[model samples]
Target: MPERQAFRERIRLEAAERFAAGAADAEVAKDLRVSVRSVRRRRRAWHDAGTEGLRSAGPTSRPKLSEALFTVLEQELAKAPVPHEHDAVGDRADAARARFQSPGPGPPGDRARRGGRGGLGD
Candidate 1:
């Protein structure tokens, strides 16, 4: 979990004190720049648990994965060799560009073939 803002911590403390001093939740909320709902919640927590309830809960610890690892993996994959029958990188890229530039499939005027769909035959 992330830490709460310093302003929020201060607001919670001041709001709790104002509540204990007989200020209405709405008035405390307005003065503290927080919602009335938050004021009421803080009031209840202060009444039940005192100032400890108003202290920041602090942040939780959790490990995060590194993004550089992903970029390294992608670069490794892109540099891997293709089969002998396939074109080299430049030729393969040109072939892909030509295929993409061709008309696409649809109805009679579509760029797609309508018969004998031949993928890996599976």
Candidate 2:
């Protein structure tokens, strides 16, 4: 887990102090402008352990895409996608067109060819 911001860490520490002084969860939550659930959770941790339980565990995540790979992905996305040898690509394109194209003033034969209703209630 990434560490909470410094202010947030200070807030929890302050809550620990209030917990030590025997302040109620609602009172702490209202004073801190934090959720009552959060206050209750922190209170439980404070009761079980000291303020150390409220400390952040530092960052545990890494970027899914690195900087160099990200640039290549950005360039690829900037260009238009073209279908090549894959037969399914054409089917996908046709499905996308059907999904996006609103019914317009076209011929009944055209609608039938596109696998749609020729008119209302068809």
Q: Report, for every candidate in turn, its global Cα lDDT versus the true structure.
A: 0.75, 0.86
Evaluated against the true structure, the overall lDDT of model 2 is: 0.86
Tens-place lDDT digits, model 2, residues 1-122:
32456778889999999999999999999999999999999999988988899876654577799999999999999999887775788989989999999887776478768786766766
lDDT of 1 by residue, 1-122 (tens): 23455777877887767877899888887887779888888888898999888878764543353578778877988996966764498788988899889575456633235344544552
Best by TM-score: 2
Residue 28 CA displacement from its true place in model 1, Å: 0.5
Model 2 misplaced regions, further than 4 Å: 1-4, 63-122
TM-score between candidate 1 and the true structure: 0.46
> What value does the lDDT take at residue 57 in candidate 2?
61
Task: Give candidates' CA RMSD values in order.
Answer: 12.2, 8.9
